[model samples]
Target: MKKLALLLAFPLVCYGLTIDEAVEKAVENNLQIKQQEMEIEKSRYQLEQDKNLFMPEFFMDFSYTTMKDTPYTKLPAGSLPFPLSFKQTNKDFRFFDFGINYYIFTGFARIEKIKISKLDIKANRLMLQEQVNTVSAKTKKAYLDVLMARAVVDVYRKQLEAVQKHLERVKEFYKQGLVARIEILQTKVKLSEIQRNLRKAEGELKIAKAVLQNVMNVNESLEVEPVKISLPDTLNIEELYTRALSNRSVIYSLKERVKQINSLEKIELSQFYPKVAAQLKYFYTDQYPYLDPKENYALVLGLQWKFQGAAPYYGYLKRKTENSKLRLRLQEIKNDIKLEVKAAYERFLTAKANLNVAESSLAEAEEYYRMVVEQFKNQLASTTDVLDAESMLTSARKGREISYYQLLKAYVDLEKAVGGSLKDEK
Candidate 1:
C-alpha cells in the first residue's frame, strides 16, 4: 500500500517536446523572426509619415535685430518736392510670426510617396511571414534529428546488452569444453565492438540534442516525443506547383517591391512639373516705420519650377530600369519555387519507399536473429553465426530508424516549399 501511495504521489513524469511546440518556440524566439517583425513596424511608421505629408505644416518664428545706423531712403534734391531722409526702421526691433504652409499641388508626387510607403509595409509583412516559415522548417528538422539519434542510441544499447548476455553464455560453454577458446575470443571481440558502437551512438545523441536546443533558442536538455510515421495519401505535382506560386511569401514580397518601384517612377516623373503652395501668415512687431503696420496678416501663393539639367528624366529612367529588373527577378523566383516544390516532392516519395523497404528488412532480420539464437542454444550454430545474425539485426534496426526520420524531415521540407501545412491543402 505504501508503494502504491508513493507511485500515486510521483505518478510518471513524461518530459517531452511535441513537433508543433518546438516550431512555436523557435518562431517565438528566433532572432531573425524578431528582426523581421521590427522591420515591419518601422515600415508602418514610414507609411504614417508619408500620409502626413498631405496635411498642412504649421511653424512659428521670433527674432530681434539691431542696426549700427537708422535705416533711411534719400532722393536727390530735384527728384522730389524736398530732400527725403527719415528713420525707415528702428535701430532695434523684435517681431513674432506664425504661419501654415500647405502644398496646393505637388504634381502627384506626394500621392505616389504614400503609395510607395504602403507597399513597403506590405512587403515587410510578407518578409516576416517568410522568415517564420523558414524558422519552422528548421525547428522541425532539428526535432526529427533528435528523435532519430535517440532511436539509434536505444538500438545500440539493446544490441550491447544482448551481446553481453551472449558473451557470458559463450564463456560458460568454453568452461564446459563445448566451445573452443577461439569462440570465446570471438564473442569478446563482438562485445567490444558493440560497446564502442554504443558509445558512439550516445555521443551522437548528445550532439543531436544540442542542435535541437540551438534551433529552439533554449539552454535546457530536450526530450522529444516519438513521432508517428504517416505518408501522404497522394501527391499531385501540378497542384503543388500551383499552390507554391500562389502561396509563397517571397513571391508576394517581390510583387510588392515591383509595385513600389512603379510608384517611385511616378514620383520621379512628377518632378518634371511645377509645385504650387499656399502660405497664411500672421505677424506682430514691437516697432514700425512710416509704411509698416504694427500687426498684419497675409496670404501668399507660390509656384516653384526647377529644371535640373535632365536630372528628372534620368531619375525616371532609373526607376523604370529598376522596375524591369524586379520583374525579371520575380520571374526567376517563381521558377525557383517551382523547382523547389518538385525536388521536395520527389524526396518525400523516395523517403517513403526507403522506409517501406527498411521495415521489411527489419522484420526479416528479427526473425533470422531469433532462429539463430535458438539454434545456438541447441549447439547447432557456431558462435560466429549468432554474432553475424545479431549484427544484421542491429543494422536493420538502425536503417529503419534513419528511414523513418528521413521521411518525416522530407515531409517538413515539402511543407516549407509549399509555404504552409499539407493538412491545410486537404
Candidate 2:
C-alpha cells in the first residue's frame, strides 16, 4: 500500500527531460569545454609546425654599397700589385641573391620529431574529451542539487503549515480551559521555531539556484524545473570497469604519452647519424666590377657528421632512461585508475541502497505524522506529540531528498570513473 501511495504521488512531482537535449545545451554553454577545445586547436597547430620541417626553405637577399680603403687584390700570377681604389663604406655596390636549402637527410631526426608531435596532438584531443566529461558531470550534479533544494523547501513549507494548524488547536483548547495556558504558549513557540527553520530552507534554495546558474552559464531570470530521471534496477559493475579502462580519456592520454616518448627517443638517437643537404643560389649584380663583387648562380651538395666528442651518444642514453621512467609512470597511472573504478562502483551500490532506505523511512514518517494529527484533534494526544511527529516527518523528507540527489551524483561519478555513460539500467 505504501508503494502504491508513492507511485500515485510520483506523477505530481515528476519532471521532464531528454538526455540528448540536456547534453547538447550544456556543451554549447560550458566554458571549460570551450577552453579545452582551444587547447586541442593549439596542439593541431603545433603538429603543422613540426610537419613543415621537412619542406625546402627559400629566401632572397639584395644589397648595395661602396667601400673605401680596402685591401689590395692579387694578380693572376699570385703577386700583389698596387692597392686598388676602394670605398671604406661602399658607395656603389649592389647585388641580389636567391637561395633554397633542402635537407636530404638528418639521421631521421626531423621525421621522428614530427611523429612525436603528432602523438602529442592525439593526446591533447583525448584531454579535451576528458575536460568535456568532467564539466558536464559537474553541471549535472549542480542541477540535481537545485532540484533537491527545491524539494526540501516544499517539505519545510508543508511542515510549517502542519505546525500552525496544531498550534491553533492548542490555543482553542486553552481558551476553553481544557488545556493549560502554558501548553498554548509552548505550541506558539514551536510554531515560531518551525517558521524560522522554513525561512532558512528557503534561503538555501536560493543559494542552490545561484550555483546552478553559474554552472549552466544561464541567466538568473531563466527558471529551471526538475526533470525526471529513471533509474535502472541493477548495474553490472564489472562491465563498467572494463569500459572505463578502455574509454577513459586519462588512460588514452597516457598511452599517447608513451608513444610520444618513444618517438622522442628515436629522434634523440638520430642525432648520432650524419645529415645531408642540397642548396642552390642565384645572384645578380648591377655595379661596375671594381665597385661591386661579382655574383653567379651556384648549386651545392653538403654532408655534416657531428660527433661532438661523443656528446650525442650520452644524450641518446639519457633520453632512453627518461622514456623508461615515463613508461613506469604510465603503469602507475593505470593501477590508480583500476582502484578508482572499484571504489566508484562500491559507492554507487551504497547510494542505491541508501535511496531505497530513505524512501521507506519517508513513507513511514508521513503516515506517523498523519496519525498523530488525528489523535491530537480527537483530544487523545498532546501538542508535544504532534510537534515531535512533525519534526520526524521533516527529517524523513529531507533524508529522502538528500539521498535521491546523492544517488544521482554517485551514478554520474561511476560513469566518469569508467570513461563513458552508464545509462540507467533497464
Error of 2 at 98 (Å): 1.4
Query: Residue pairs in steric clash, candidate 1?
Result: none
Error of 1 at 216 (Å): 1.6
> Which regions in candidate 2 have their CA more than 4 angstroms from the true location?
1-23, 73-92, 285-293, 424-426
TM-score of each: 0.91, 0.85
Give the per-residue lDDT digits (tens) of candidate 1, residues 1-426: 999888987745657889888989999999889899999899888989988999999999999988888777677678777787777678888889999999999999999998888898899999999999999999999999999999999999889889889989998988898999999899888888888988998999899889988888899767899877465689899999999998899999999999999988888888889999999999998655665568899999999988688898899999999999999999999999999999999999999999999999999999999999999989999999999999999999999999999999999999999998887454
lDDT of 1 at 91: 83
Q: Where's the lowest-lDDT run of ten residues in candidate 1?
A: 286-295
lDDT by candidate, in order shown: 0.90, 0.78
lDDT tens readout by residue for model 2, 352-386: 99989999999999999899989987888888888
lDDT of 1: 0.90
